[model samples]
Every structure is written in structure tokens, then in C-alpha cells.
Target: MNLADVPKEKLSPMMQQYAATKEKYSDCILFFRLGDFYEMFFEDAILVSRELELTLTGKECGLDERAPMCGVPYHSVDLYLKKLVDRGYKIAICEQMTDPALSKGLVERDVIRIVTPGTLIESSMLDDNANNYICSLYYGTDGSCALCFADLSTGEMSLAVPQGTTDLTVRIMDMLSRYTPAELVLNAQALSLKSVMDFVKVRLQCAVTLRDDACFSLDTGRELICQQFGVDSLELLGIEEDGAGACAVCGMLDYIRETQKRNIARFISIDVVDSAETMGLDLNARRNLELTETIRGKERKGSMLWLLDDARTAMGKRLLKTWMEQPLVQPLKIMARLDAVEAFYKKSVSLMEVRALLDNVYDLERLMTRGLFQKASRKPHRVT
Candidate 1:
């Protein structure tokens, strides 16, 4: 039902609050925090009920029409949130901002987090080995595009700016396939760019969010980068001043800020990737090489990685994948890696004992990440 058709005075006090908040995030499903449940109302209720197989119900909101409703317990909300996010839908979590017992009127609340396919940090919602990335694309007027990828789960951030070549579509698709972002954010105005837009919509088929074109700005973006990375110069981070990469990063922060509604201490640490020094591989090359999977039907059983991967821990497995994707182009770095491997090879007696010990080890990387995030925002400083 069109909520606008109902008179504002007809809504209950609580529902008036809901309607106001809903207007701002119309594209997303609002999970209003009740006492112990995350409630969805109106059309959002009907939609998620069918999608998540929740019981469809109704609530009397004092309006001419009864509001549709569905809900899940707050403790088990992650399961429901994952379902919507997996289906490419965004969810705004309206939280009680104050102690409900102390409040005289209705409990004061606001949306604390707007969860999207990207920007998820909870361990249960993410994969152990694969990185969860949220990327922003800036289509420049000069026929070039600047893309920024940020993995909040791992605190990894990188930017790439390249002009359209004869094989522009393939190159763009290759870059997308390489990282495999959970969501792609772009300017609403750029949807008119037929060829490029079609690739994002059809070929990629990932979640795409369109924001106002005015939200992306070179100066604002540079400031955001400087604030986040604590750098005075963009060039220091390998991002050009007033360039496409800069614009893309700015756009990314914009969407993140709008959704998260809080500080992103996890993403404060950033890395400027040197794409030139790494070997580049496309999707086709990855499949043909069978680096991580078999060529016959793409399973892990007969792959090169399957045979070579004797990794005992999650971090080791992730590092192995990195090695498979980007072999060192510099001879010095390559030699250093070879020397390390050679040392391991010669330690025949110690290597077997070490591997046996590591088989019982836990995933330290993700455990430390969750610990640091949940316990405190400030990370412990390293000793020099």
C-alpha cells in the first residue's frame, strides 16, 4: 500500500516515527528494533515474509488500513539479515539509542547500521578464505574509469584508474571478476552510459546501488582519504590528486557513511596496491590455469592449488591464493620468495613437526579481527 495515501494524523506516535524513517531509506528494508525483535512493517513485511518464509501477520497502527508485519528475534537476526543481503537487498537496522526503562515517552531510537552485501564484519556472515569487498566506480567524462575496492573485513583498500581501450569491456569485467565485490556503487547519472551500464547490470549481476551524482566530488573525496589514512598528500598513497581513483574512493566513503552511520575504525588502515608490479590474470586465464580449481568442471579435487596447498591455517590458505593470483614480476622479490621456500624445503625433519603442530591451530587473523572490533575501536600499537 502507498503509505502517502494515509493521513499523517491517523498514524500512531510510534508509526509516525517509523514512516518518517522509512521515507529516508525507501530502497532498503527497515528492521525496526522492538523490545526483543527486529520488526518489519507494511510492504517490507510482506516481501521478507515470502522471501524468508516468516509468518505473515498484521498490526493495528490506528490508520484506515492495517499495517502488515513480520519479525525475527533480535538474537537470531544475523540469520535473517544474511538472507536479505544474499538476495541483494539492503537492510537498515533501527536501534534503541537509549535505556528504554529510563525513557518517559517512547524509547528513543535511530538506525545504527545499514547492512549491505559489502561492509559486513561479523564472522558468521562472511566466508573464512574469501575477501568481502565493497567497490565504487567513477565514470569520468574523459572515457576513463576509476575504481576503488575496500574490504572492511580485512582492512584492505586499493584503487585503480584506467582509460577505456579497444578491449575495455573485457578489461573492466576482468577487474570485477578478480576481486568479486559483494556490491558495486555508482552514480545514478551514469546509468545512461549504455555499454558500460549494461556490463554492470547484465554480465556482472551483482548488487548495484545508485546514489546522487552530486555526492561524488574530487575535493571532498580527497579530504575523506586524508582523514581516514591520516596522510597530507594523495600521491603518497599512489592516488592522483583530483583524479578518477580519488573520486571513486570518495564515492565509496559516501555510500559507506550513509549506511554505517558510525565510525569505520576497521577500515582506517588502507593499502595502495601497486598493480603494475603484479602479474594480472583474467577469469578465463584463471579457469584455464586451474590454479584453484580443476579445468574439467571446476572442482578443487584435481586443481594445482589442491595438490600444492598443504596449508594448515586460514591465513596460510589465503596467502597461497594470493601467490597463485599474482606471481612476483620483480626478480628481487621473486628470489626472496624462492629463498624462503628453499629454506623450508631443506628443513625436512622440522617441517613435518611444524605442519603437525599447525594442523590444530585456529584462524588467528579473523579471531584477532573480531576480538579487536568487538572489544575496542583503538588497535594495540606495535612495538618497534
Candidate 2:
């Protein structure tokens, strides 16, 4: 169903509008806002109908044959969207900008936001204990690479620049395994790097996105970082503008703004992660150890985390997993963690009471972050 084959004059006014919007977002499934439903037409209609098991229907456009059509009720759109996103499909949510009843002609509609695997924030679409991270990778010509990880649901951003490594690929893959990002955004250089791209797309099975090269420029990155942190320069934050980390962060921020279609006030600061502080485990090592899941079935059973985890809340389980992946290298830090464990062991009664209290608690970190983002965007925030 190529629209290019159909003459513009043959399309009805409303369908002409859909064609124009769909042209701009050809990579995504455009959910065109119609009265009480988000409708799909032509290719989108046919594909969505089969995927969601919706009835295949037709509509009278200006053509001799009716246009293929299907739709889901707008109120229950999240369920359909979750299914599509989980299947690795991107969606462009076309929303009506004005009331149709008040308009004299066709209602004006535009894509308000894009929903991707990385940018998901709805509670129903996410796992409570896992962070859905969207990663940005910037590969410099000088053999340096920067990786940035951000969880849109939690508003947490962190960057890692692995330097002085003989095999940068191993370090890069190690970081990727630790975070297990749902999506990866790359610059021109990074996209051209065949090894990294293959590992991300094939081994990790992550969605890859390419943005404009200008977004990763050094000067642009510095300016965006300064503006985001309300600082005069990168020096104030101990970050070099020419560095790989800055480039990665800048590209990430640009990508997020593009998908979200608005400024994100959630990122108040950026954390520069020091890889030396923790024991570095490459991809193979993590897989062999089965730190989080078994290597065979990739399930939580028979894994180190499964054996050790007794967390009462979602946040605690996530924190435990984070700790398991990044073991502290410093003796003082290790001793501090052991001391805390010893204290909890000595006061079993108090620990039991604390666990009981945590059982009633929700994931406050993401809950509050989603509330703030929604309020800033002036949309309803749903947290379960």
C-alpha cells in the first residue's frame, strides 16, 4: 500500500491529511487520532489488524476501492501500544490538537509523542524491578568511546568513558551487559563501527537508532550540558567538553527530546561513572558467572541473584541486582557493605520489622519521577 502510487487528488481531505502525517513518520506506526479512536489506514491498518487481531475494515476515501482501516479505542490504547512496543515497533501518537466540534472543517491533528522501547514510562508497560534504559554510544576517531545510560521512567542519567583499555570493545560490551539497555542510539561513527553494532543488535538484541551527527558535536554537547545543569561550563561539573562522555550525553539528550517532543525537566544532574571503582566484568565473565540469570535458559532460577535475593520491595530487588553486577573493588567500600550486612544479621528482629514495612511501599523513585514529568508536560500520569 504505497501512497506514492496513489494520486494526491484521489485521496479524500481527511485521508490526505493522514498521508501527509504518515509520510513524516514512515518509520513508525502512526496512530491517527479520530473521534474516540486512534485509527490506522492502508499499510498500518493491515499490519495492525493482523498483529492485534482486530477486524479488518474499510473506509470510503476518494478512490474506486475503499481504503483498508482498523482502530482500537483510545481509552484502551495503552494495552495495544505495550504489545507493539514489546515486539520492537516504534509508534508515533498522532493526537488532535483542537476539539473537532469547535472546528468548522477537519480537526487539526499532529503527532504529540513517539513511544519506543527505551522511552516507555507507563507502569503497566514496564517491569517493576528492572530499569528500562536507553543508551547512547559515541565512538571517537581517536579510538575512544563513550557510553551513556538513561532510564526515562526514573530520570536517572549516567555516563561512562572507558579509557586506557587495550580492547575497548570488551569494556563497551561489559557496560552494555551491566545496564542491559532496551535501545541504543549511535552517532555516524558508532553506527559505522561494525563490531559494536553487531554485538548490540545481535548479541544484546537491542533496538538501534541513528540521529544527526550534529547532535554529537563537542560544542553542542558542552552547551546542552551547561544549560541542563544550570552551570556556566563543563569545567564546573568536572567534565571536558571535548571528551567522549560529553558527546554521548549530548546525543542522548537530543534523542530523548526528539522522542518525547518536549523539554525534559527531570534531568537535574548527570553522574560521571568511574569504572575503576568497581570490579570490571566483561560480557563473557558476567555470562559465565550467571550473576543475574542463568546462561542456558536466561532465567532467574539457578542464578546468583536468585539465590541471594530476598528483597521485600521492587526498589530493593533492583538495588540488589545493581550491587551484584558492580562489585566494589575498594577494601573500605567492601568492608562498609559487609558491616551493614553484619548489623542487619545481629538485629534480626529489627530487620524483619523493616522488611515488613517495605512490603507495603511502592517504587517511589519512578513514581515521583513520572508524576513530575507528566505535570511538566500537562498530561495525565498513570502509576500502578
Candidate 3:
């Protein structure tokens, strides 16, 4: 719904303002900043009240029927947000834009940030050892598609183009399962593909957001990516000469702009992984091999990782998972890994000492992510 679609004639001053704001963020569950509370009204209130198991209450609107209303304390908004996001919902945080004490009539309010499952950086909202990847896929007219991944918690971004093959959907679906992003943004072209669309919604069970096809243009993509990465050209970022990968990156960036109104996911640098460089595994293969989890019960008990993993820290655990999923195809890289293991084995005393020291180590990478979110959303809780 747009502003015009809102029932302007029926709503009073505050309700009218809310109606307009709701129109703007129709797709999101908006938490409108009211005094001491982040309130939801109308349909959003009804949905959230049921989802969060909050009291389904009512508020006065200028109409015959009372408006549905629900809220949580502003100070504890993150608690509610976590619940909603965990259930695959996006939250738009509307904040009072002006000082209530100084304002003449009603306080001016605007969206501060829009939070989603994929872009959440708060420590309370993320898993310690798991990567929270937000991905975007762009489908080109030539039956080729590019995918990009961004992890807000680690500031790791990557891009890969699916190898040109007849069974493209299988490859794409496998890649999706491998990364396991919380949210995905697809261009119009990608969303149009029935097979791709079904895989995203059914197989991956990820929240899908759409972008315009024009945004996926190669020139715009290169310009947007180069600007964001602070590079002169795509070559510096190791993006392919073709723009499909860049387009996917730009589409993801655009979705960040839309969903994360205030805090966009930070990207320090990108690591481009070529498809041929790593061993690729499909869903069936992963299930049969029991690489991460057992086949029947789908638990970690009898998995290969369960047998091999003895990592001390969350970072080590996450890295180990990645290494297991995509073992090196290159012989030299494999040998280098073996050499490191051999060195560790040869010096048993040093290995034991190192392990002991690592036992006390904290997950600094996740700490950095939480710190970044705190800095971005840091503000005094004033009625403004």
C-alpha cells in the first residue's frame, strides 16, 4: 500500500502518520516508535501479537472500529525482534525523528533501521559458531546466473558464477544448501524461473526479497560494487570480467539498503571463490556422506565433522565446518594443509600448549561484529 491507499479521511493526526509509514513499509512488520514503547497497529499488530504471543489489545483510531495494537518496551525491543526474525520476519524500526519536548504537536518519527534474519549483528541474535550469510542471486537472459554472499557478523563477502551446465538448477540449489543464508534477494529474472523460485521457498526455506532487473545491469553493478569496495575497478576486487557476479553483489547491496535502513552490512573486503577451485557437493551427496549431520535423524552425532572436530573456539569450529564442506581440489593446497598437520603432530608438546592457550581464547570475530552493531545503533534513549 502507498500513502494514498491509506484511509486518510478516517484516521486522526497520529494514526494518519502511522498509516503513511505503514504504506511505505508494507512488506515489513513495522515497530513504530511511541513514547516508551515500540508499537504496532492495525494488521501488523494483529500478526505480531499472534506470532510473539503478546496481548492482542486495541487502540483508538478515528474510525468506528478500534485499531488493533500491541507493543513491547523500547528498551527490550531486541528481545521481541529476535523472536520475530527467528520466525522469518523483517522488522522496520521507526524512531521518533524529532524531540518530543520541543515539538509543537505530535513528535516526528522515521525508520532508523530495518532488521532481518540475514543482517542481524547483535550478539543475542546470532549463533556463536555459525556464519549468518545474506545472499543475492541474479539471473541473466543467457540462462546464466551469479550469486553473492555477505556475512554481516564476519564482514566476509564472496561472489561465484555457476558453471555453465544443463543441470543449472541443481548446482544453484546445492550452493544454496552449502551457504545456508538466512535471506536471499533475487532479481526479477531469477524470481521468474519457476524451478529456482520453488527451490528457494521450499528447499532452502529462506526469506525472499525481489529487486528490479535494471539494477542488475553490468555497468551499474560494477559502479556500485567498485564504489562500495573503494576500488577503481572490478579487477582489484577479483570480480569476473563479465558483470553477472557484480550484478549479484549490487543486488545484495540494494536489498541491504532497503531492509537495513540504518545499518548496512559492512564489507571490509571480498573473497571471490571460483567454482572449479573447490569440490562441490549436492544435497544428496552431502546427506549420503554425512559430512555435517547424519542422514536419518539429521543430527550431528554420527557425522564426519563430529568425529574429526576438536576445535577450541567458535571461530575454529566455523572454519572447520567450511573446510569440511569445501575441501581443496588442488593437490598443492591439500599438501600444504597436510604439512601443517604433520608439523603439529611432530611437536606434540607445542600442540598441547597451543591448545591449552586457545582454550581461554574468546570469539573475537563475533565480538567485533557485536561491537560494530553497537556503534552503528548507539544512541541515548531520549523521547525524540
Candidate 4:
């Protein structure tokens, strides 16, 4: 069969299924597993090859001609996946659902997972000291809505119901700092709220989930909460809809149930406080003063992670992780941790001085990557 003579109208069942899957997840890079490699086709092939620095190639699809294709070996998927995610791309992993040897017809193909930066669970892609968050919003019957957000990695949870304009910004900002959610959910009717959410989304490169109009009711919020936690009613959680707070809390829990991939059996104790309870810091100050920006680059050999290595004790390492999880909260706790850090700094024979340090360390992206990869050259003695 000639290369150009492949019948466009006579595509095999497997080819048809692949085309349908491609259409279903148009926005995502579909990693279609064929055998040893995760393959990309047509435009996905071109785009992925260029972005990932992989070789561009083609495959014979049992037709008169070859189809455009590019692929990376299954074992090296994590490396390429990390690169794509770091560049802010969502991936839909489409695996062959059935064994080719056992199945009679075309090999079954289905999307097994959708990977995003914030939803990542692999230890290599995540920081032990940082939290990955997913958030959802529910608009009530009135002109109000509840925002629910959770971080499964660290088991942190938070809720906020902002009524007027003043509280809205404060609440949203507070939630942003408190949870650092990677994705957000909201109803279509909540345009104003969506605008605020969008600002956060773009600035933080977060994902958003817009609910259908049919599910925009307050009862839906409660039902979602009940369903997520597998409770018969909200009463079991000691929460009632006396006001908007319950709806907000329930909506967040519901969002978590729908989106979270893992069964997080344990939750870390979260100390809840209003934005007013803590001193407000501007976005610039928060990012710069706290060293949040240092962790944005390559995984290992970053600055924040470097500081964590020199933390000297388990408590210090735990504190460092907590700082990355909720960079804006618990100033007192951070100060206490800083004191411990300072004691170590003074005693250690490092060239850097302790007196020049600021309240919150800056260049966070650098710090985190460095700390994540830190390892001792030799085994240390185990102390009793």
C-alpha cells in the first residue's frame, strides 16, 4: 500500500477509538500507550516533541501510509511529565484498558489519570514540606457563595463565606495563602466571584472547575458534602445551614471528594484563623519576603531546600515544610522555628552570618529545590 493511499474513510476500530479520545480531551496532551512508549499523534506529536525535546517520528497505522507520531519510553515518562508540568501543562494519561493478547477486537483505550501540577502525588514531583491543594466554590440562592478548598498532601482544610465586598477580597486572599490550592470550582452564575477566582488562577497558574447550572443550589452543596465524606447528613459533621458558612464548608468538602485521586486517611491538625487575626502582607512581600519564589526552578540544588538540609533536627525540617504549605499563616510559629534555625546557624561553621537574616527568608523556589535533594555524603552515627 502506498503511503498516501491510506483510506481516510476506512479507519480501523482502534484508530476510530483513538480519534474519539483525542476529541474528548482536546486541551490535554493525551499520552496514548501502545506498547513500550506513550505515543502522541498528529499535532500532539509535533507539540510534545518540540516541548519535551523528544525525537519526532512516525508509525505505520496499518494503512497505505505512516501517521505522524512521537513517543517517550514508559520508564522515562516521569522525567518528561515533570518537565511538562513544570512548564504548566495538564496531561491526560490514556492507557490501553484491555490486554491486547486477550481481547478479540481493538485494544480498549481509556483515560486512566489526569495529571496537573497541583494534583501531583509522586514523591519526586512533590516537596515533602509543601502542600498541594484543590479548591471549589458554591453559589447559594442569595447573592452569596461558599468557597471550599483542601490540600490532601498535608491534609489541610479551610472554608470561607464572604458576604460583602470588604470580606470577599480578604477571605479569598486568606484562603489563597492558607491552602495554596492548585484548582478551583465555581458555578456559572457566580460571575463576580469567578472574576476574583480568575485573578488568583492566572497569578498562581491554578486550574478552575466550573459547575453546571443545575448543581448551583444550596442543597447541592450540602449533598456534595454528605456524599464526599460518606455521611448520611451534614448533622453528622456537627454542621447546619444556619448561615452561609455551612454551605461554604460543604462545597469545599464536595469538591475534594470529586477531584482527589487518593484516599487520604489522615488529616493534619489545621489551626483556623481569620485574615484579621494575622497581620496582612502584600502579595509581593509574601512571595519575596517569605522566599516562596526560590522553589520555582529545577528540582534539586535549589536554595530553600538547601536551608532545610541545614535545619539540623527533625522538628526544624517539619517546621520548614509547614512554612512552605501555608506561607502566610502562623507568624508566631514561624518565628519560633526561626529561633531554632538561628541557633543552628550560630553554632554551625558556615560563612553566612545570622544577624543579617530577615523575618522570613526570601528566594523560596531556590530554597525548596535545594532542600528536597540534600543528602549526606556519609552515614551519620545513630544517637540513642
| Root-mean-square deviation (CA) per prediction | 4.1, 2.7, 4.5, 8.4
Residue 306 error for model 4, in Å? 7.7
Better by lDDT, candidate 4 or 2: 2
Instruction: Give the worst 10-residue stretch by lDDT in candidate 2.
Output: 375-384
Candidate 1 at residue 101, lDDT?
91
Pairs in steric clash, model 1? none
Using lDDT as the measure, the top candidate is 2
In candidate 4, position 374 carries an lDDT of 41
Candidate 4 has what TM-score? 0.67
* Model 4 C-alpha lDDT per residue in residues 1-384, reported as the tens digit of each score: 321234545665666666678777776788999888899876778888899888888766656556678898997788889888777777888888889899897888888666766556554566544466666666656766566556554455665554434656565665565556676666675556654666676666676656665443456666655555567766665455445556556545544443343333333232233444345544544555444445356243455545545443333454565555445457787688789768866777442444234213432432332233241123321111
lDDT of 1: 0.77
Decide which is better by lDDT, 1 or 4: 1
lDDT of 1 by residue, 1-384 (tens): 656666768899998988898888888899999899999888899999999999989888987678899999998898998989999999999989878899899888798878999878776688665678888978777756777898776667777764444465565666776776889888764565676667667755679888777667865667777888888988888788877778888898888778877556556655655666676677678879888778788687788888887787766876787687666798989999999889889998888998888877766655565664572224432211
lDDT for 103 (candidate 3): 99
Better of 1 and 4 by TM-score: 1
Residue-level lDDT tens digits of model 2 in 202-314: 88898888887798887666777888889998877767768888889889999889888988878888888898789888778898999988999999889999999888776
C-alpha RMSD between model 3 and the true structure: 4.5
